[model samples]
Target chain A: MPIKNNNNEIGDSELVDSARHGDTVAFGELIGRHSDKIYNRAFSIMRNREDALDISQEAWIKAWQRLSQFNGRSSFLTWINRITINLCLDCLRRNKRFNAESMDQIDEESGGVERQLPIETPNPTRRLERHELRERIDEALQQISHEHRTVLILHEFEGLEYKEIAEAMECSIGTVMSRLFYARRKMAVLLSGLRQEGY
Target chain B: MIDERKELKIQAYLDGELTIFGRYKVNRLLAHNAEARRLHAELNSIQELLHHNELDHPLPEDKESFRTRITHQLRVEGEGTSRVPNRIRPVLKWVAASAATALIIFAGVYSLMSPENSNQTPAHVLLGGESIEPEAANASFITFKSESAKLSVVWVDTKSSPVASPIN
Candidate 1:
């Protein structure tokens, strides 16, 4: 016997099954549940509101098409998150190609002649009020390169494993660690500068 | 990247992803190196802030439109792909051609097999009270009468000479 949809009150597995069978309502609920998360992931990576919204919608559409392939191995949101990240990565790569020579001047990897130590500056994040601290960090994140910001977001915010980040970013584990370390180093410098400037 | 190995250890330790051996080694190094300790503290503070805070600033308007737009896009895409596939067009044409040919063959066979459709008498029989020599009549013409209508029918044999021969 065919199972009834039960009025949008279904689990991810049921929604996935129905959506696979071409039920738009079931698919719509799934989108409603995870759209914000997917959008934020895109926004963090793209740093642009329009691009984030576009990537979020694109990811959901892709999820619907590949509904049959969802084997319940991971949560629906995680699967969608990976999709959003990949889209953002492709966007960055296209931009990089267009301005290839500009990124050439920046060091691709960490570890140089000096540690690039910050002079004794008070920790701005600690001293600032909570809301101020949050704003400061978001502002600092916007200043870094896409590659560095991505590793930081994946590791520090999304909390993905190094192996997972490597696979998602399509780089070596060492590169994941390297990019992450460089990203943190850059964040530290940026935050320290913010602290000194009292912003 | 101050002391690349140490920086990696700091990240691994902060993320709680280090092996037992790695954790112990980093722990020993952390107690001894001021730079490693400072770096670890800085990274840990950052992680703490991230964990406690979120980067999202979504408007209610944005949230509502996300659902509306995705639903609209899915409906449009669904209608497109569910239509007849181009890949099957050639197969459908072939099937149609085959069906037409079979229909023609069937009508031809049915006409030949039906008694009402017979226009030729047996090769040696006399017809219309004419005493035609068996060989000459067999090679020339034959006639049929529709039993239901009492109608007379005439036919000309094409295998003979071109002169028109009538069946009485």
Candidate 2:
């Protein structure tokens, strides 16, 4: 649906067909339509600007190379998102040794592993302006580790099911659920912290 | 840690990733216990936040530069299918050799650094070195005779790697 840009009169399906035939212009059109979303997804997963840039470009190159293999089973954006997500996952894996041991380390100040921070207000996010809420969410996300954050992005933002997440993460469905659960609880703590900060 | 089974039930109920019976059980539990209700409300608010308030981070402002870089790369790749010009053939081999040499030197330097810093090649190191896309290497017929050397450069695609999560 995002493919119908004013500058590009063609639909995504048409562009994909042309790009499959090696039309650079068609592929460029496709890139123009979806690169930002792909870049955003990369940033969400990688949590670094430069890595997001490299990974996003790499995803495009891969999409261009693998264009013909695309069967139109999913939307073009979905296809690109999958490519970007996989690349992010790959980048994360390649560099996993450099990161923290695990995202499972509970915050010392959070009191315990089963931190259920009381939601003081009825709906804190409702009180926030759109941009302010995003800032708060981004801040909260930065506090979580890659594993937890990745699950949150894949489930909530990308709308992938637990099984799909398990497949992408190469883990069991229960692991996916566990990570999702941990991520949500962590988010609750972070959001409540923001509420306390008067954000 | 909380009761693992009870926590799972609460998350399942909130996610609606459960069967009818599991749903009924959590519903009854939440109705009866004030603590469970509070926990449910806290968890459910996160869902609302993610669903209604999640915002995408902005891309770099100079997006056109990125597009230009990708466009140039695509054009270069398009030209790759054509025959390598005779003049550049020898240069490419020398470059590969130089790359191998440089890789060894860089690896030695990286290997000696503080364990924390040497865990992975960071941003500056990669920036300073020449990069060949793995696809570009795939198109070439070079082979490393040394098993250790080959193993060092082997690409590990994380998609297929075995992932062990804490829950598992």
Top candidate (TM-score): 2
Please write out the lDDT profile of model 1 over residues A1-199, one tens digit for every residue: 2345564567777777767777777777787777777888899888888888777778888887776667789988888888888888888777773246325424546464225665223454335667877787899899877777888898878878999888877789987888777677667777776556663
Worst 10 residues of 1 chain A by lDDT: A97-106
lDDT of 2 by residue, B1-168 (tens): 335567668977877788999999988988887777777777777877778566676668566666777867887887875344333555776776677667656754764574654433322244443333322322221112333223234323222224454554
Worst 10 residues of 2 chain A by lDDT: A103-112
Model 2 misplaced regions, further than 4 Å: A1-7, A97-99, A103-112, A116-126, A194-199, B82-168
Chain A TM per candidate, in order of listing: 0.81, 0.86
lDDT of 1 by residue, B10-94 (tens): 8889888899999999999889888788788877766765675656756234555778788788888768663433345457657
DockQ of each: 0.19, 0.19
Model 2: per-residue Cα lDDT at residue B130: 32
* Candidate 1 interface RMS: 4.0
